[model samples]
Target: MTQTWLITGASSGLGTALALAALRAGHKVLATARNPTKAAQENPQIEELGGIWISLDVTSPDTAKHVTDAITTAGGTIDVVVNNAGYSLLGSIEDMSENEIETQFSTNVYGPVRILKGILPFMRAQRSGTVVNISSSAGVDGAPSCAMYAGSKFAVEGMSESLSKELQPFGIRVILVEPGYFRTKFFAAFVAPAAGLTEDYVGTPVEAALKAIKAKDGSQEGDPVKAAQRILEVVTSRGLGAGTEGFLRVPLGQDCYNRFQTKIDTLQANLTKMKEIAHSTGFDS
Candidate 1:
């Protein structure tokens, strides 16, 4: 089955990788970024690969309509929509400026939501489509010094999960991807600040987290190409069966897998204790 894909942030990192992978899979891709010229940074060869690049600033409310138009103009109804364009605004809740926090939600949360809002009409009309939203490990298990970033991703996860159930009857599948740290400019580039704190605050726990992030920005072992390949495999190359949930949440990388296990362990440990209060604390119960 040949599927057309509309991918956000296709200029670099996972977006670029996935865009290429989709192309390699013989799928049509409508790739978009804040700046198409900036997207040509690492992969100038992408231009020759039949990947259509379009200008898109997710922060803008009207950007999703532009994205939809690009996708429609390139071909037709988008079979798969990958919401992979997001950045981390690493900072503690208090350490973030007002505008910085707003920017974070604007890009990471609201942008994706509005984009989906624009595309859902098309997908619903098609009666069969998939939406793969790229959330982060920080979104699931939380991490030190990444509270704001994590919150944005958490919002994505929650929305995707609920939408999956809602769209099930409509034959529109929603897949949530939780990726661990990978070698991307995301952590290296400070798109948003950690707030302007005093020099004394530099060595504080929040600052330490920032320092740790700086050190690990490009050190993660996850391969973006491999992750992209896996995504395509799940969505296209392979299938479990008719009416089977192949992967509701695909956790890529060893870090993601391990963190998922750890979260499961914590949940299991608390399960018995949770039963004790389940009935007592709830008025409905």
Candidate 2:
């Protein structure tokens, strides 16, 4: 079956891979970036594969309007929407400025919210659609120097979970793609604190985290093309995701799987350990 896919941040990385994959699969792709001219120039293969590029900056307040307009120009129906435009803010929470934090949330959290607002009405009217949110393993398990990024992804995770339930009656599916490190320009593009590392963070986990991120930039084990293919499979209910339509989240790498499992284990242990205390908190009944 052919479908129309709206993928944000399609200038590079996973977004570009997904656009190409969908186009090759006979789907119409509306790939969006802040500057479609630059994006097209950078990834001519998208156009070569029959994908169309549109201008859309997730940080802009006009995100909803722009997406809606694009959809209208693309034949009035959308099958899938992928919110993939986001950046990481790496630094201790104290080291980050208010502007930096706000910018992070604006792009990572609010961008998807705007997209949902624009797309949900149409999906509800049609009674069918899929919303894929590109989150991170850090969303499930936070680490030092990743507070802002993790917080933003965590917000997306929570929103998607609730949205899945809310849109179930309308036959809309929400999938959170919690990917681990993939070999992309993500690390290279990550925003660090303008002030740089503070003296308090010297020789601390924050410093070590920064070093590890720099070291892992191009060496990340996961492949964006593979990840994009998997996502397409899951969305289309073919290949690896056959007969798995009911799943809500797809963690894409060994590192992500390990982190998710560790978080689950920790939660279970905490619940068991705090059961009595939790019970004690209840009012007399």
Q: In TM-score terms, which candidate is top?
A: 2
Clashing pairs in 1: none
Per model, how many backbone clashes are there?
0, 0
- TM-score of every prediction relative to native: 0.91, 0.98
TM-score of 2: 0.98
Q: For model 1, how does the per-residue alpha-carbon lDDT over 207-272 read when each residue is reduced to its tens digit?
A: 888788888887878889888888887777464323335558888899889998999999998997
lDDT of 1 at 38: 73
lDDT score, candidate 1, position 129: 93
RMSD of 2: 0.8
Cα deviation of 251, candidate 1, in Å: 0.3
lDDT tens digits, residues 1-285, model 2? 899999999999999999999999999999999889999999999998889898888888888888889899989999999999999999988989999999999999999999888898889999999999999999899998999999999999999899999999999999999999999999999999998888989899989999999999999999999999999999999999898799999999999998889999999999999999988986798
- For model 1, state the Cα shift of residue 225 in Å: 0.8
